[model samples]
Target: MKNMEPRIFFKSSRNVAADTGLSKVSLRAGVGAFSLMEMMITVAIIGTLAALCMPAWTKIKDNSMRARDVSNLRGQAMAVLAYAGEHDGVLPGRINRGVAIPSTVTTDSKRTYYLSTVLIDAGYCSKDDKIWKTVCGYGADQFGVAYVVNSGKSSVPTYFFGNRSSTAGATTYDPKRIVSLKSNLDPDKDPKGKDEEPLSQIWMITNADGENYNSSTTGGLSNSLSEDVRTPWGGRHYVYFDAHVEFKRSGEYPSVN
Candidate 1:
């Protein structure tokens, strides 16, 4: 017995190997541990799972942002409605297009008014740097007036608040026409639901009528707009005179589909 070799027992061979501080087990009947291949497989599985989740995550994020953009439209609409209530069912009917004034509404009335200005004046929206500026739309960091209305009837000298179609309670609305929307395409180009845009894609060309849109951009209506200031999401947001907001697939002007 005194000549017998000393023996040690480990709760598990793995622990013994761990104590040895060796890279691999060398003992007979060594307890098994994960190999490099097993670790690699586990990593691949995890990577695949992440890949699968990415699209769904993107979709959810897009939906949330779209919802937020629509909410902004609704908020602006509410303010417009408030203005209408006070001014004999009229919008904040004072806008100054850099080009020419309309014969119907006199610019001589008072001061110039922009969409965001009016919203701020009425306290419906915050300051421009805060409200009109959004992380959503054509381009992520894109800023400036993110909205415009169906302020005009047929293209003419009219390009102001009163110029666009009546909000709620305005004598009428062209059912086939779109009201206010996110600035994706040329505001001058009236949406007629003409073409199928790429999914989640806002237009880059200004389809506005250079005649009425007279501007440095030219040939359309006025010169107030530029070559696609920024890119927007694929979806177009529509706010009708009814005041209820609707989110539909992104399409060109006129259609509002």
Candidate 2:
């Protein structure tokens, strides 16, 4: 009688075997599933890699910007030379010449190039002080010389070079004679004494006699280029007096001679 009850299990046993096979397959499919700690470790590694790369990326961006500034300055220098040639080998006077190259003259351009009134009438310079006292000045010291004297107020001075100041007839200005062509990150230096001696030493442009360079808060024609020289859109762009366009940098510049 007990054997008769057990005899009905044939098809049911087959169904049980099929279910077991499916369960095994499901378990195999999940074999590579990650644990919580493993996932966290992977995320941490990715974050570390990103942090390591950040500083290098920033340096690359800065170098690229510096290169662009150099290119822009060089182009502007060429334009000035072309203008001088067209005007009977005579360089421009302060106001007229500055207008000829609107890019250099304007405060809007965000980059600067030193200008000189040496080629203009010498009478424009102040006899008491060797500074050029017209709308433009010789070096950074004489820049805004007329503005300071005429206004009788010591406002901060601005020029094709950069910002400067004069105090009690003592010119307080940048010290780096030729801005380092390599970087514009130099520290600021105030003019030293009452004789305008500190201001006279700086150059307005690049020249064979080393008189072409100018002192600027952002460095002049020297290797030390400045970050301010970069255009908002990136890269340096300049227009010269001859209406020529130039791109320049540390490696390439015009010779004064």
- lDDT winner among the candidates? 1
- Tell me the spans in candidate 1 whose CA falls farther than 4 Å from its real position: 1-34, 96-111, 128-131, 140-143, 153-160, 163-232, 248-252, 255-257
TM-score of each: 0.54, 0.33
Q: How far out, in Å, is residue 10 in model 2?
A: 20
Cα lDDT of model 1 by residue, 52-139, tens digit: 9999999998778767766766666666667666666555644532212112123433223455554454666564444333445343
- Per-residue lDDT of model 2, residues 67-142, tens digit only: 4444434433454354455555443332211211222233532212223232222222212322222212223222
Report lDDT (CA) for all predictions. Answer: 0.45, 0.32
Candidate 2 backbone overlaps, count: 26
**For each candidate, C-alpha RMSD in Å?**
11.4, 15.8
